[model samples]
Target chain A: MELSLCNISYSVPGKRILQNINESFKPGRFYGIIGPNGVGKSTLLKLLSGIEKPEQGEARLDGRDISAIPRKELARDVAVLQQGGLAPVGFTVKEIVRMGRFPYQSWLGGESVDPEPLINEALESMGLTGLQHRRLHQLSGGERQRVALAKLMVQQPRILLLDEPTTYLDIGYQLQLLDNVRAWQKSEGLLVIAVLHDLNLAAMYADELIALHEGKVLARGVPDAVLQPDLIETMYETRATIIRHPELDVPQVMLAPGVIKSNGLLSRSLEAHVRRL
Target chain B: MLLLAVSITASLSMGSAGLSFADVWGILLHQLPWMPDADTIWSRGEVAIVMQVRLSRVLLAVLVGACLALAGTGFQGVLRNPLADPYTLGVASGSSVGAAFLILFGFQLAIGVWTIPIVAFLTGIATLLGVIALSRSNGVMQIQTLILSGVILQSFLGAFVSLMVSMSEGVVNQILFWIMGSLAMRGWEHVTMLLPFLLIGLVILIAYSGTMNLFVLGERQAAHLGVRVERTKLIVLVASTLLTAAAVSVSGVIGFVGLVVPHMIRLIVGPDYRYITPLSAIAGGIFLLWADTLARTALSPKELPLGVVTALVGAPFFAYLLHRRMKDQRGEE
Candidate 1:
């Protein structure tokens, strides 16, 4: 499956959140979209996932415009996990996961037996087998993210859109979530696109990276090429060092705290550097 | 199911015109050979009072209870609020105003006994439609705003009803009886009046059970899952209100059943509407059947108001549930 965004722009009232932007995602790859706050990373993901229509552009799944497909049909092709998926009171982990099968089930036919097998498989893969019956509110943030992932897994969509799925998790759970996603993408040849705040995590897990700034694509390519220290420092307005992982040879970013100075000296230099970049 | 059957049978047998189970069944079977089966042994008056009078009233109680509960379930689901009931949208108050108006002015205009209920039903539907239209913005209906509007409308219409009642002289008892609600004089005409709306409402509500489940996740989430959120809500609101109107048309205003039954069912059997809708129908029927039976027997021949019975039972239970839920939240925190 391939997801391509063409000249996508989004504006609210007088302010443009996203400018004309273009990006494409392909199967069997983990793509990370990263940016600072208020950069429209979430908006771009929403556009790609068909949650929000682009104001002046279009997103295509294969050759078909996503807007042209019915929502139910589109849901079967793409699964989106929004940040902190709210668990309505009383929803069990398994029931939450089962909602992914909404596009497949009929009103009276009940849930598909096939989806049950798939849900069980997803739960087992995420190590949620013992917690299937647990209420979502009872789970820790990491476990909830896993449950969300399990939901997407049951969806079995060709394209997966995740928005800051690990924002609330500890480092270990973050790695565990990314690892599980990567494994599933490998085995199933799924297209995984995630919005991540942690550059190092993105560098570690993403096969490719797209950096969005002010709703436009700033840089996109292989993670190694996109995660350069100069790009990170320029985008984030901070000093950073980019290094290679000892074993995997992936880019690893190490940030240096801004040098504090009176009279706004440090911030001005950072601003000037960003402008120069 | 068995309990429902037992309650129905008991409701039929235990009225003022006393008939044993066998006698009730015999009357139902029409097994008596002679006309009125020896008038002295079994008075025609007793048989007439029991079979013709009480049976229809019992059926009306069951039907109205089912309608109110079904509408309540639908409203609660659509609003995503457990506190919502059939009358939360002001249908009951609006209908009361319409009925009161008819009693004060229209009855002397030579309309039939059925005219007021019909007018009340129409006014209820109109009021709901107005609320829906008012609350809509950017194709979305804000449930909280809708509820607030309903509360305001209810208060306004309630004032109108009170004003009409105060001004009217001869119709005071009639107006009071309607306001208090009853299953006393309801017959086949009332049954026929409510049956269609109830059936249609049930079908529409049941059809949207899956969407209701999605809705509980929130409107945006349901929309993402391919639910036509606004359209579904309109259908649910209109249908549920129509059910409330129909029930109110037949038997004045029966409160609390709608608010309490669905909530209780939710506690017993998770929040799934598929289970909740049908279970609420049966449970509500059983509830009102017993409540009406108590109304008939608790005070002997002089019956208590059906609405009073429901309030007496439901209000305490609702308060307890609210307290318990609050405590659970505190414990969790």
Candidate 2:
């Protein structure tokens, strides 16, 4: 089995974050996890990435317990892109990307195989070659996030996990970022499990979608089956309209958002928002 | 290496005795076994001053500076706080209390002059343990909790030291002067005492310098990047704490060098720990060497405190660098 969870359960001091999660993720495919906030999406990612131990069950990769795998070996197999992206430290773009080769380096930072070509290639792919010498603080948030992605690209992990990596990007750049990741996932024959807020993007990119609700897997199937309007509404507790994409064979979601006052006049804020639109 | 050698030679020559560089070099070279003992022209008095007095103190200053800087770099790297230094946890203050307690009770020279330094070193280590014990919870030491715990220990120990200082009216002058810090008359003993810690800490830091770079992203990212975060942090923390304690034991609380030297290195060399770690040690050595030289020779016979010299020179220089960096960032943006 690839990275798989067997009856995983996690809890904080007074709250249960995840409960009885049993899922086996295979390589050579992309999976998207969608849920509302506080539904344990990131927590599950942490468990799979071996950063967090499940309270009840164990996460396993390749038939062995994930936590039992030495960190460097595990890192060589898995790379995680944390939520909010990397912070603005003073490292240059090249330096940050080069760090992705840590698992392959020696105590004195000597790598048996030269990583310069790989780092240079990753930088080129992310459109960061021009800013390779610039410090992280000098880059905008979108550029910083791209730098993080470039770092992971050089890592060449078998499993790439992302948590809201699109938070800082504009729509154009978000599509560009995902397109790069998707291309890499296909070419490298790796697995991509991303916790995504944008249901449409999840539907477009993920081969399979896992919908988490209240710390459990509510649905798991092809996007077409998982993204049904009733299931989306049940998971998010908000009305959503689902339609097949005109250009792609995927379901897209449109928020059907409104609130009614007792007097039945459009709320002052909604009227103002409509007027501005 | 060549610069450190030159700086050490220059410092050895220019004391209140006013010897030249050639005289200093001759005095130093004359002691070499292969060099002709009869070829030495320096007087016994000059030799004594250079070999016994200035050479030892200058080397001590170099060792102390390098230790502080190395320790500071490790602290800043692991804690991911630019403001962290050897003194951040008040180990120096804790050490001072030990030294002061012994001095006030007239037990400083009871077991010879070495007793105070030994006691100070013990207390410094004890304080580190206390900080670690306080900060750690559920086998996890978060950065904020660690820093807060350090601050708590520092203020408490600082108050304890003040109380001791107030109670000892007779030896208060000695305690205060020593606490202000001096590298005076420290012979081979203090140099040898601090040497092993510096060498060991430097070696450990070099091996882990790669992981230190990941620390800038934070502990969580460092773990994800395959660093054994808890193991690395604890080993680095203990090593740096010992380095700081050894330095403090010999030289008292010589502040500012540890706090500013690493930042200066970061500004010049950028944030790669591989470079920052070694560069900080060397730069700290050079900075403290000169500061000590100025401290001894600036006022000549009076010999100003080394701590005052470091703060006076370091603060202004650091302020200038900071101002320039901020302005550069603004201009670039």
Candidate 3:
């Protein structure tokens, strides 16, 4: 594992979000963190990405504590993509992607060699070649997300942290985005940790799936081992049926409504069902 | 740049005394040591008026305009607010308090021409520091906190200014006129005081323009991209505030130029601060030069306030730009 979360815990004022979470992320593998709303999957991603500091423990990159590394040095190796992607800045797609070279560029925005070739490569891979000169606000939802990924690719980071990157996308976009990310992760040998809300998509894309519940890791293993129906039911307190994909051999989650109760009557309030769990 | 030069030349010739453009050019050329002696050709009084008085005032207009506009661009970028201007940090109110204190107390330092502007400069810097100190917690400056502190200080200092205004006997109208903002009778002293700050602030802002591009992603994303968020924010705030304070001290309180000029430039050049900052400086200088000329010539013997001229032109121009942009968006859609 290139990045390790050692006994990480974080809390804000009265609310404890993440508690005693431990995980190791190796290079060349995609890890999906799955949890219900407010379970601190996003918080954990923040810690690992070095955007936030843990309250009780340390996030280590290599053998060094992450906090000890200067921000620019860490930036050269780690990149984070947040939900909603980047705001619609009035910059062209090429200009926005060029900004990812911020860590390597000088004060006057000069690079050693011309960065246009590298930027072009990133744009080509993200399928943004035709949109290079287009302004960010002019792009569609999927296009903007791809532009954001192109920017991250230009940064050339070894570790990628994505926080609900596909939250606002449709099912097709979600799959397309994940497919692109998986391809990039394999090609670059990147350690990709993503906070994914869609369990089916997460199980399909991620090499390992970590199930978090109430600030703790309920299960952590390969998709087939951790994406079980019982684990999903216990963690989320929702009835779910899990079955392996016929070709892919990865478990997929199917919501089985009102199946938790013997009478097959769905509870009107989720809080009541959660209390029962 | 050509427009600015033309405006400056026109302004040099348009005072109460009628000097033609040729006379203005000749008089300006005569002052340069490298040029052939044209001093004897023009009258001494004309030479003095064109070179010393009118030239200084026009240069001061350019300096103050450039500084305010550049500061405005920096503030808008860092705060991520389209409405933010150079004066959003309470520099105007603080300088007003300083000028009011000077006028009411009749405290005349031996600093001669430096008296009012110097006091205002010191007070403006103090106000900025106080706002930053109040807003920053754990060395991180929160945008909302900074704006709130500025508003609070403005109100607080505004009360002091009102008290001083009420207490003053003589110099009341003078203080009021000064506060209204003007570039009248400004000499090389104002230019000297403003130059260093403008140069230094521009250098700092230009150097950081690239990092400013990342700011549109918001603070967290900027940091994730390797910008030392707090450090960059502090430097930009200080540098831009320096530009603002320097302009406010010399010019009293010129509004609208700082707020509208950047937007005007952004409309032409897009929102990249790297291009916006330099272009805003040039356009701002030209804008204020023309406005100042209009202010001086519009009433001939009696000069209108510089601030009024800028607002009159700026408000209508800004409205037109907004309308055009909306139309463009409609077209795009």
Per-model DockQ against the true two-chain complex? 0.46, 0.71, 0.77
For model 1, residues A15-96, the per-residue Cα lDDT tens digits are 7888877777788889999999988988877777676778898989997788778777788888877776666457788987
lDDT (Cα, 0-100) at B14 in candidate 2: 83
lDDT of each: 0.83, 0.89, 0.87
Chain B only, TM-score of each candidate = 0.91, 0.97, 0.96
Number of clashing residue pairs in every model? 0, 0, 0
Q: Which pairs of residues collide in model 2? A: none
Candidate 3 Cα errors over 4 Å, as ranges: A259-277, B108-111, B169-171
Candidate 1 clashes between residue pairs 3 or more apart in a chain or in different chains: none
Better of 1 and 2 by TM-score: 2
Give a tens-digit lDDT track for model 3, residues A16-129: 898898888889999999988988988888788777889999999997888888888899999998898878778999989988999888777788988889999999998899
Per-residue alpha-carbon lDDT of candidate 2 for residues A74-149, written as tens digits (9 for 90 to 100): 8898998887888988888999999999988887789888889999999998899999999898888888888988
lDDT over C-alpha atoms for residue B189 of model 2:
87
Cα lDDT of model 2 by residue, B37-125, tens digit: 62357677888888778888888989999999999999988998878999887789889989989988999988898998999999999
* Worst window of 10 by summed lDDT in candidate 3 chain A: A259-268
Q: Write the per-residue lDDT of candidate 1 for residues B1-333, one digit (tens) a residue.
A: 898877877788996666898777666555356445544556687668666787788888889999999999999999988779999998999899888888888472356778878888888988898787778776768888999988888898899999999999988888878877888866888988888888898888898887798887787667666666778999998889988999988788999999999998887787788889988988888888888889889989798998999999888987887788778768876
Leading candidate by lDDT: 2
Candidate 3, position B20, lDDT: 98
